[model samples]
Structures are given as C-alpha cells and as structure tokens.
Target: MNKLEIHSPNSPILLTASLHVDEARKAIASLVSDLLTESQSRNEAGSVELVTLDQAINRILAEDLLSPIDVPAADNSAMDGFAFNGDCLSSKDDIVTLKVVGTAYAGKPYEGSIGKTECIKIMTGALMPNNCDTVIPQEFTESSDSSSVTFKQNQVKRGENQRLRGEDLQSGKAAISAGRLLRPSDLGLAASLGIATLKVHRKLKVAILSSGDELRPLGQALDAGGIYDSNRHSLTGLLNRLNLEIIDCGIVRDDPASLKSAFLEAASLADVLISSGGVSVGEADFTKQIMQELGDVGFWKIAMRPGRPMAFGVLKPADPKNPDRKSLFFGLPGNPVAVMVTFYQFVRSALLQLNGANQTEPPLIQAIAQTPIRKKPGRTEFQRAILERGPDGRPTVRLTGSQGAGILRSMSEANCFVILHHDQGNIAAGDWVDVALFDGLL
Candidate 1:
C-alpha cells in the first residue's frame, strides 16, 4: 500500500492520507473555501422580527444604520451653566454681568434668543437658545439673583462646553455598518440615534453530536465499557458562548447505519454539523465510511501530534432528499484533548468562514521555556504549560507533565500551550518557545 492509502476491510489502519501537515491544511482550507462559497448561495429564509432595542442584544446588523437626523439634533449645552454670545467676553479678566433671559432644561427648548451682552441659563443636554455661541459653566459664574448672574472670568472660547449638532453623527451618514455584531455599547449608540428597531443577520444554526458505544448520558447508569459523553456537553457550552443556535443530536452508536441517519437529519436542518469520534482507523470507526457515502470527505490527518486524524468535508445527500443542499461538517477525534486541539485549529476556522468572520487565526505570543524537553521530529506538538511572570517581569512558561494525547488533566492544569514546531527535535531550558494563550476552553 502507498503511504497515503488506508487498507480497507480488515486492515489495522483505519484512515491514512498521503499529504503532510502543511499540504493537508492547504487542502482542507481549499475545501472550506468551496463550502463557504456555497453557503453564500444558501439564502437565509428566516423572516425578520422587529424587536425593541432592549431585546436586540448580540444580534448581527442586517442593514447599514444611517442617522436620519444629526446626533445632539442642535447645538446644546454640555453642562449646567449659562449660554451667551462668546464675542461679548472681551478678555481673560473681562467679567460681564447679564440678566438671564430664560431657563432651559433637557428636551425643553428656551423660547427667547440670546443677543449681544445677553445670556440664558441652561442645564446639561439642554439646547442653546438661538444666537448663543458658547456656554459658561456654572462653576465660573456667581448667581447675583434668580434672573441674573455675573461671570467670574471671561477666558472661555467659542463653542467651549457645548455639544455641536452632528458632531458625533451627521444626517444621512452611516452610524453602524451592516454585518456588525451588536453589543451593549452598540445598543446605547443606536438608542442615542433614536433607532428603535435594527435589522441584523440571522443567528447561525449549528448541530452538535457525540458518537461512541462506550458513551453514556448524564445521570445515567454507567455499565461496563461506558463513559459519560463529555465532548457533546463541552461543545454545546462553547457554541452557546458564540450565541449560535445549537441543535443537539444527542448520542449515537458507532455503526454506519446510525451515523448515516444522524448525518441526514443534521444536514437537512443545520447550517453546520460537528461530530466527535469514529473518524480514526478502527474497524468500528463508522463516521469515516458514512462520510464517503454521504458526501465528499475533503481532508483527513493533520501532522499535529495530539490531533492527527482531523477530518473536514461537506455533506451531500446520496438520495434525492435535497441533493443540492450541502451541509458543512467537522469530524473531531475521540480523545478529549484531541477534540479540543483539532476544534481550535480546524473546526473554529470553518465556523468563522460560515459565519462570515473576517479573521480566522487566533493570537500568538513568544515566551521562554522553564525546562528542557524532548520529542520526535515528524509532527508539531502543543505541550500544556503554566505561564508565569518572572521576578524581572519577563514571561516564562513550564510544562505540567507528560504530553500524552490522553492526558487531559495536564491541559486542565496548564494555562497555555507551548507550541513546538514540526521540525524541532528537542529544546533546552531557558530556550524561546511560541506560546498560544488558552483564551478559553478550546
């Protein structure tokens, strides 16, 4: 058999690929580009809902929100003081005592206009009466009587302590662009612009699944050869944080027939399908077989140590049940640590592309290793480590323990992953290492 070939039938190797790490990634990215291109054609059928500003939190902007009117609406006072003609204040020491023509409060305009040597008492957010050019803060003026005040100093400049109309947003200008995800501050900005309703992109629908005969549900009796399904729960929580619509497909057997049914159902309803386990080289690894039957399995096997057999593909119906509808899928490995590493490296990128995210890669930083480490030279490695600030304030990191695929406790104890490049064989203490911060689980 060739290096890429995986012997079928009763062969020991379940699935193998000829491509190396970089080649595999490029191939997978190519497939993902196709899927993303096709996804663009799948028009969102969900109808829009006119929700109030309070209810529109975290939704995508469906259309560009333009300002119908300028923010501040008109020239207004920024503080509680007096509005006056700025030219009347001649010098720094010049103090002009003027009668208060009218009092103004926020949302209530002062009827009378200010003339030369005249002023109007105004409150915060209150509009300046016509012909007033500047506002003197109340702290700089002394109240001589209820209807008059004396300026203590005359150093204020024109438009000082005043909010000019359209300073923030001009009429017909775009206040918020289309496809922006709404946040608290965004909501407040929209509210300030008098926008009660906003059009936003529909929430992405994702289907999550976990497969293994040894898996058991929560609060269920664990018989022999059974383990609780932690991958499904972990993925569900992660997707929840992204604010996507999650369709839990629950647990399924490691059989080809069962996987086929689950894939069909997930493909029909969900925008993306994520499955854990049954993609390795085992005889019972039905996910690999089922993937070939259902659609095109683009790439499998990344030359990353912990996550080697990562799979990416688009599901197409073999039968006539919506043959044109292609559903994106990511087949993560069975080991918990492998699941996480592959998800972050591969699945996350795919999801971002599906969601129209602009940036696909996470941030990276460089740090020094605390101890010497040894490894084989074929694949890259992600060693779990705890990063710390040294006495000199420099960042340093130390690996927890054994860097095994099954050692999930090591990942839990470490705060970051010290990345070892593919060609690297070993490292000495105090050597520089590339560290990827564990921003969150996966």
Candidate 2:
C-alpha cells in the first residue's frame, strides 16, 4: 500500500468520508497515500553514494550496516568492583574474605587467573579474568588492605556486573538497517562499529517558487497590496533541515507566460518543485493550466480547516531530448499559516519517502486542554497551542491568541498543534487532546 505507516499505541484513526459528507472533501491521509504512490511510480530508486561518517547526517542509508567484530570484544567489568568466582556466594549471615591478587585497569588485564578465595580489584570496563564470573561493588565491600578484600556473601549474584561478549551487537550482524534517516546517534553507532564511511542516498534537489504579483522580495518596499515573501524563506529553512539541495526561484507574476516559464525552469533543475499560492479554487488556474500542459496534475479540496485547497502532480521539463525526465510537484495555499500547516501535514513526509527514508510518523503526545476551544465537526483543525507544564507538573495545552488562517503570529507563538480530528467537535477545559509538537524533546 502507499500508506505513510503511522504508528500509534492508543487511539486509532477514525476519520471517515461521512465526517465531511456535506462538503465532499478528501481526507488528509488519502492525499498522502496518493502522493507516495505517484512518487514510487515516477522514478526508479535514487542512486547511492559513499560518504564519510561526519557527512552522512540527514541522509538515508542505502544498505544494511553490519558489525565486523563483537561489541566489547570480550567479557568486561561494568563497574569498579572486586571480580571473583560466584561459587563463593552463601547465606547473608556469612562474610567472605578473599586475597586481592592484583588490580586491573580499563585497558590492562591481570596476567594470571586467581584461585578459589582470591579476587582481582577491577576498574570499570576492565576485562573480567578467566576464573571470575561475579563482581561485588567497592562501596559494598568492607575496608580492605592491599592483600585482602571483604564483603557479605549475599552482596552479588552469579555473573553480576560482568558484561558478556556480543551482548550489545554480534560480529557480522546488521547494526543499522537500510532506509534509515541518519541522525547524530546513528553516526556514533557506526563509529563504535569501526565504520568510517557509509553508503547513503544522494541529496535530493528541491526547487521552491512563489507565485503572485503582490509577492515582494527582501529589501523591496511593499505596495498597498504587496507583501514580503516569507513563504520562500520558511520553505528554505524547512527543506534545509532535510539536507536537500534547494533552488530559490524568485516570485513569478500571475500571468500565464511567467508561471509557465518558472514551472518549466524549476522542473528542469530539481527532482521536486514546491510552489506556494495560486493553487486555491477560483484563483487564476494559471498554475494548474501550465502544469497540465507539461504533465499530469490534480487540484484537491481537502476537508480541513486553515487549508482547504491543494494541488499535486508531476511535471516534465521542456527539454525534448530527455522526454522521460519529470519532477514531483506540491502546490501549497497562499495564506501564511495554511502553507505551514499543509507542509507539515503532507509535504514533509512525502519528501522523506521520495528521498528513500523508511516511512515513519511524527511524534505525538496527548495533553489536557487548559481552556475551552470552539471547533466544528466536519473539518480537521490544526490549532496552534502553547504546551507547558501545569501546576501539577503534567502537560497542559492552550490555544494561541487567534486561530485564523492569516494569523502568522499564532504559528510563531505556539510550540505545538492541537489536532482536532475530522469527526471531533468542541473541546472543553480539562479534556485530553492529541498534540503534535513543533520539535521533540531531545
């Protein structure tokens, strides 16, 4: 299936077509599946490249990474303790005294094994000696001289504090799987496995363009109807987080010629093209008209608040020689908050899949509502909210100042989105609600 593979432990998604029967709008999940299906059908998988461990962040793994050797290499001490044979363990009433043979540091091991009633003073991470199978922490042992150490017989169990070989990872085993989005922790793991270079997917090329005559670039004065082009800058930041190669195509006028030229140019240079504005119903239709001329496209009336109109399709380059060359297209609404909402809900996950990442869902947490929220039943609402600890130290969420589509400040002041589902209605104070956070607590 072309699903995004969302994972949830508690409540399952119950959104159905009957929720928006009056408007006949499509569901958000339906759109995501279609986009994924289109992406898979358009291209054979992207080629892989070899890169140093430091350069692999945010890149997708093309193959499984296997460990060449067992982790730890041998049995080792998990803490600073006295290592001795576990056969000496007895009743809690008995105290066992053993001769201290020698000391062992992290990288140094005792030359010879110890006999019964003998133990070695071992530091953390030091290899356990051949005759030792248990450890008694130094703090639990009574004061001991250079020759001997004393501890209660019931202090530790057999094999306690001894790290077994291959316990973390075995030799020739898959340490990291294919299609993983490499994080800093993943790099550390690869380094621990002695892997210096990784096979990863090449960077995806993305082109961003803004449409509308009223859109003004930086350093330009805005006229009565003109506004600064904030969407491009926001899109750039979002795409940068994924490490994609971004092309900033300046704003295009509403005319057919300009929109057509901009679309064709971006398609030629990028694997994916994202255009904001001019996609909604009754808006010139220049974007859709030009897109259809180049390739196939569809305009959707999604049943969601803040963002209702969306467009998705594939566009081919103007080049006659490479007729099969195409680029995936995402058309976002013009309203500032709507653009961000739709991007997070749809475009981000779709791009990750196209870049060869394993499909995964964004982290979500349920928080108690601090105040009443006015909402209708048919449409899904992505209401911006502030998530913080309440007086009792539990998470509590409250909506931002305004929930309008044009309120950019609402998105700015909020740290999360309180998702009121399609079939959901008004939320009262103290009611639990599902929240999608802006960033995870690392």
Task: Name the top TM-score candidate.
Answer: 2
lDDT per residue (tens digit) for residues 1-442 in model 1: 1111222112222345433556555545666666656655775356244667887775666677898989878889998888888777765556778887788999998997677877888899998876887888888776555778886554467779999999888999999886565678889998887889887656678898998899999999999889888888778866765667899999989777888999889988887888888777663245656666777564366668788776666677554755667777787888887887777666766665556544556677888888898866778888889999978888999999987887778878989988887888898988888988886435
Taking the tens digit of each residue's C-alpha lDDT, what string does model 2 give over 114-176? 988899999999999988999889998977778999987777788899999999999999999
> TM-score of the candidate numbered 1?
0.74
TM-score of every model versus the real structure: 0.74, 0.89
Clashing pairs for predicted structure model 2, backbone only: none
- Residue 262, candidate 2: alpha-carbon lDDT: 88
Choose the strongest candidate by lDDT.
2
What lDDT would candidate 2 get against the real structure?
Answer: 0.80
